[model samples]
Target: MSTAQPDEGTDRATPDALLHTRTGTEVTPEDVVLAAGRDVTPKNLEWAKRKIETEGVAALDKLLP
Candidate 1:
């Protein structure tokens, strides 16, 4: 599996970092990683969290695009 590596300095993010507690309908980072046959890593999780924070739920789209 191709796992992404985080650049130095940023705090490592958990796989569930991007998850929304109020809305129980979003696909989690773990699920996305599993479905893509990739390993979960702090960097990937961080990226996911960053995207969500910067782009709302639409981050999922840019995260791939």
Candidate 2:
């Protein structure tokens, strides 16, 4: 992720633009939080990173809508 900040009205660093910088086919942790109408926190980002490392990216689909 870049050193940029989330746009106004957000509570975390990972904004949708930064979150979607990678392949558009995958849903990032930030996207998950946005889907739930919440802000992405450090803990959430950590959890998502951990899950991806432990279970692989495909495992993330289970947490998506």
Candidate 3:
């Protein structure tokens, strides 16, 4: 995952707006949820976590690539 520093004139930096990979593509929490095959909701993070734990980083190949 990547971190973003707020640009000039921005009020705040949002983690959800940061890119999660080196390609510089922006990703939202909703993108993460959908990537993990779940609904666009906060609870989907849990599903993503479980998938990672069970399948390893390779599980995210489709999403990240």
Top lDDT model: 2
Q: All candidates' lDDT scores?
A: 0.57, 0.61, 0.60
Query: What would the per-residue lDDT of candidate 3 be over residues 25-57, giving only the tens digit for each residue?
Result: 544445556775677665787767666667655
Which candidate number would show the highest TM-score if scored against the true structure? Answer: 2
- The candidate 2 region of ten consecutive residues with least summed lDDT is 15-24
Q: Counting only residues 3 or more apart in sequence or on different chains, how many pairs clash (N, Cα, C under 3 Å) in candidate 1?
A: 0
Question: What stretches of model 1 exceed 4 Å from their correct place?
Answer: 1-24, 31-38, 62-65
Minimum summed lDDT over a 10-residue window in model 1 is located at 56-65
lDDT over C-alpha atoms for residue 23 of model 3 = 45
Candidate 2 stretches greater than 4 Å from native: 1-27, 32-38
Count clashing residue pairs per candidate. 0, 0, 0
TM-scores for all predictions: 0.39, 0.42, 0.37
Q: Mind giving the per-residue lDDT tens digits that candidate 1 earns over 5-58? A: 887877865566575433446756654444445678977776556656676655
Which is the better candidate, 1 or 2, if ranked by lDDT? 2
Decide which is better by TM-score, 1 or 2.
2
1 versus 3: better TM-score goes to: 1
* Global lDDT of model 2: 0.61
